[model samples]
Target: MNDNTSMGNGASQQNHLNGQWQGQPGQQGQGQYGQYGQPQGGYQQGPPQGGWQQAPQPKKKNWFLRHKILTAILALFLIGSIASASGGGSKGSDSASSSDNSSSDSAAKSDDKKSDEKKSEKKDEEKKDEGDKLPAVGTPVRDGKFEFTITKVERGKTTAGSNEFLQETAQGEYTYVYVTVKNIGDRAQMMSESDQKAFSSTGQQFSTDTSASLALDGDNDFFLTDINPGNQAKGILVFDAPKGTKLTQIELHDSFLSGGVKASL
Candidate 1:
């Protein structure tokens, strides 16, 4: 009985050992499966947390990109606008300067022209003043008989067919001389034969004893015209003197005297 009891205790101990070995393998496999399942939950929590951080990063990147593009465009536009404004200002200044120069040149030319015109006018006035100082010609002598006050004298030709009754064949040289003659004393003077002959000794013959009659002397061929009281008679006398003659005396005939006094020219 003691041997049978010791053999039963040994078989029981062997069976216990085999069962522990088999259960250990199963427990280890189950623990490994449980650990894989728990890792799935941990992975879901990690995705949620990381998704929040990534979402803000994409938004910030998009905002930064848009802002940079806008700033570049604004800077380029400002540069172009400044260049255009500067060019326009330069053109305006040049135009203004050109206009001012043109106006100044025109004003200068106008002033010069005005000055020239004034100078010309002044010169003309001076010339006119000089001309006024010259002596006059064809001065009258006396009412009836006329004589010349000679500053210059010239010799002339005598007319044909004249009676050489006067003692002096040639005319006298006189610087100044007066001629006197009688008026017809009456309303009219009749021409006698001798008077007509003597009068005809002049170059031109009187047609009638009219107040306005003209006669020329044959001796020197001097011109003579008849006159009444207050009537102006004129005659030309020849001189042998200088060119520009200036007469200084004038003489008239009195009622009683047939001889004339000296006169001025």
Candidate 2:
């Protein structure tokens, strides 16, 4: 019996070492049966044998996907801003181009106006030159202090003095021109024979032959003679030139330095 008891005690110790629990003898309490083999206020049991399974984390929605309306509104605003900027730039370029074109047009108009004015002034000058041309023959013309009338002309004379001692012969054939001079001024004015001039058809100028004019028979030769105002003088001017020299025009002046009038011969 002692050997059996020792064997039972050893078996109980061996059961405790092997993590096996056994009920104590005579310790059965009906009210405490719910607390049987449970430790008091100790650590809870570990997780199950399959290892811990992490709960599926709540899935986070993408920011843009969650706020679809706000995203669309932002995209539209960006597009409108770009479009407005582009439109404003185009408008500025067009406005600058228009201003440059307008300035060019104004410059063109100003140039045209200047050109027109120049043309008008040139036409006026031309008209004035035309008005200053000499008139025809047989018309009485007034120079500074006198009015001259060319009456008639005679050509081909050789001898002129009445006296034999005072006779004068022509180097070339002598031509005679008849003229009437009238002093229309307030003072006396001299009719000078030297002031008369003749132009040939070839534009050659001929001066008066004063020596031949002084040798004339009568007092009808034009010399340096003064005539009273409102009086007239008739004279013949002597011009000596080579034979067959046809005089085309005569220029007559009131004084030595006066502006002359031309008459067709």
Candidate 3:
């Protein structure tokens, strides 16, 4: 019985050693499977099955990339804003420049108008200055003569027996006077001899005679013969007055003699 018992104990020891060896192999296998297993809970939770893993799933998408897109949009917005500002500034500058130019033009026009007015005033002054340089008519001088009296002084006329001659006188004792003169002293003396002969054929004569039975208060006509030395002439006379009348001054002027002489009657 003792021998049998010892043999049984040795077998049991061998069996324990075998069980330990088997347990060690099983633990090693479990460690290897833990390091490289399929995903658990629907997610890959271990190291890669091949030599490398999927590069950490690329870190979801990445907020920086999204930020880049937003930044591009912002940049575009900035560009548009800058362009609009520049355009507005240019337009305003152009408008201001145009206004300034117009103002300058208006000022220039005003200056021209002022200059024209001044010129007109200067011309008017010159014209006034030119008007102060002429001569005026003067009164006359007289002298005595061989009993000269203006019988009839009137515009000249040519008619039978009165070709530029004094034809009528009053019924009084008087001396007639006829004077001929010119304005510029440039015309020839008297009518030609032929003209005088023709006038005489018409019973016309140039005379300064007085008659007792003559009719005055009518036209006294005469022809211009010559211009006096000073382009002037005078006719003076004396007449038989009504008993106690006094002699007076005489004045003479034009010939044929419309506007001839004035006697203080």
Candidate 4:
């Protein structure tokens, strides 16, 4: 009886241990789904068919490659800044200098224009002073101390005479040039017959005849005579110009100091 009891207890203990292990999981690693539908620690398990896949990690980018254009621009800007600082680019300064030069040129041009204008004005004044009188015939010319007018001119006379003087024959044909004169000075002015002159077209100059001029006309004769202030004298001046000489112009003078007046014949 004792032997039978020991064998039965031993068999029951072995079966209990086997049942405990088989109830939890199979010992061979639970076939394809290891630890299938089981909880590990405090977490529950998902379906075995759907396996978890790891997400890919992002790759790092090169700093220069990511912003190549911007990086290049920034690098160039840095280099230019350094270069300009060292070399003194002087862009703004150069502009200032150019403006100064341009202003100087403008001022110079203005000065030149003013000089030219002054020269032109001076020339005009000189012309006005020299050409103050009309150059036409039959117009009276008033010089400093005298006013004179030409009335008529007769030529081709051989004998000239008057009651006061003996008749005289001209070496050449006589030319009678009639004129009127007025003394504009405050005092009496003497009219000189030698001061009268006539020019020929052949460039010959002839002076007035003293004797022939006195015998020219008794109505009015002017030669060596004192003309009172504001008084006038009319007379004919005879000249022995060369024969066949064409008269051109006549010049008259009031005194030795007079700048003579010229009138075209």
Candidate 5:
């Protein structure tokens, strides 16, 4: 009868522990052991379906990549700005070069025109110089104090001077040039035979033979004769030159120091 009573009390204590572990309503809590030999509230359970996991954190995107349209627009704008600046600079440089070339061309043209004008003026001066020629024979040329007119010329003579005592013989041949001299100045000028010169066809110069004037017959005042102003005198000039020498021109001067006037014979 005592053994039955002990069994009954033990069974009741077990039931009371199970009720506390199960967390029954209106039941006071107690530290209880589970069937797995662990504390009841501290027991660990397996994952429901898959392996163990944690809540995933979202990935962050690059700011430039996130706003693709804005980034692309900014890139395109930069590229276009660079191209425009480059094109504008090139055009400006071209314009400046063109301007410089134009200016240089204008300056060159101006210089060319000046050169052309100078050439034209030179040509005109040359033509004027050609026009101002010396007068021919019988055209009345004047020196400083006398006006002379060459009348005639004679060539090929062996001797001169009609006076046998003062007569002169030619070393070469003798030529005679007849001229009329008129003094136009206020004072009398002495006509000098030595101041006259004769040129041949080949430009050979011949001087007058003053001693041959003594051989001349009749009114020959060629020997250092002084003529008053407004008076005229006839003179003969005798030249000693080679045989067959043809005198083409005669230069007559009023005095030895005077610049002569040339007349074609």
Candidate 6:
């Protein structure tokens, strides 16, 4: 009886110590199985693989629908900008062209005015220099670069009475004048029958008659001739006029550019 009582007391004491270890409600305890391998206090848990979730996608934008007024304003602003650029370019081009044309026209008119002014001044000077430009026959006149003397006047005559080849009867009566031209200039002087004109008393002018020129003998005509410096040309010019017409004066020119000298018949 003593051996059994000692064994029973030792077993009871061990049992009491084991119960103390499992005691206390709502106390710290070992982890139970749950999602993410975290502790769950006596609750049912899903599988660890089901804890993984896809992130939410961002919502797609509806830009036109979200800001209707801002979209309309941007569209109108773009159209206005395009229209203004186009119209401004065209207007600028037209303005530039017109300015260029106006500048060209102004330059042209300025040049023309200068030319006309120069011409007017030149003509005025020429008029001021013209003297002894008009005179009568039988008068000795001094013109530019030359001196003229009307020596004789013979009317109603065709040609001189040479040995042969004389035109005695002409279509109209003939008049003759003896003239002498002296070149007082430094250069050679030219003479032309066209430069000599016979004026009737009635103021009618006649050119030299060439019909009887061939029949006449002698170098008395001054056509197509030149006189050197300090030299002279003595010539006879013939004309045809109405019968009994009075030869009043003669006009002579040394050159086409010479002012000319006149002499009374």
Q: Which is the leading candidate under lDDT?
A: 5
> Which has the higher lDDT value, candidate number 2 or candidate number 6?
2
Model 3 C-alpha lDDT per residue in residues 1-265, reported as the tens digit of each score: 9998999998988866654433234233223234354222234456666766446555566765769989888889999999999999999999999999999999999999999989877865653343222111122222221112333322222111233353443333343333332343344333111111000111222223232112232322222334333454333222333322222323443333233333321
Candidate 1: C-alpha RMSD to true structure equals 21.3
Highest TM-score among the candidates is held by which one? Answer: 5
TM-score preference between candidates 2 and 6, better one: 2
lDDT, candidate 4, 1-265, per-residue tens: 8888998898888866654444334344333333573332233457456787879999988998899999999999999999898666577678888999999999999999999999877865654443344354567887767888887888899889855357788898998778888999899988886887877654468888887876655744465678999999888878887688866678889976788887766
Evaluation by lDDT, superior candidate among 5 and 6:
5
Query: Which residue pairs in model 6 clash with each other?
Result: 136-263, 136-264, 137-263, 137-264
Indicate whether candidate 1 or candidate 5 has the larger TM-score: 5
User: Each candidate: RMSD to true structure?
Assistant: 21.3, 15.2, 20.5, 15.1, 14.0, 11.1
Q: What TM-scores do the predictions have?
A: 0.26, 0.48, 0.29, 0.47, 0.48, 0.45
Supply candidate 6's per-residue lDDT for 169: 57
Candidate 2 backbone collisions, by pair? none
**In model 5, where is the ten-residue run with the lowest total lDDT?**
31-40
Output the worst ten-in-a-row residue range by lDDT, candidate 3. Answer: 192-201
CA RMSD (A), model 3: 20.5
lDDT of 5: 0.81
TM-score of 5: 0.48
lDDT of 1 by residue, 34-102 (tens): 534333212233466436553445434565466997878888999999999999999999999899999
lDDT of 1 at 118: 91
Which residue pairs overlap in candidate 4's backbone? none
Local distance difference test, each candidate: 0.39, 0.78, 0.39, 0.75, 0.81, 0.72
- Tens-digit lDDT string for candidate 2 (48-124): 77989999998999999999999999999999999999999999999999999999999999999999999977865
Candidate 5: residue 145 Cα off by (Å): 0.9
lDDT, residue 186, model 1: 42
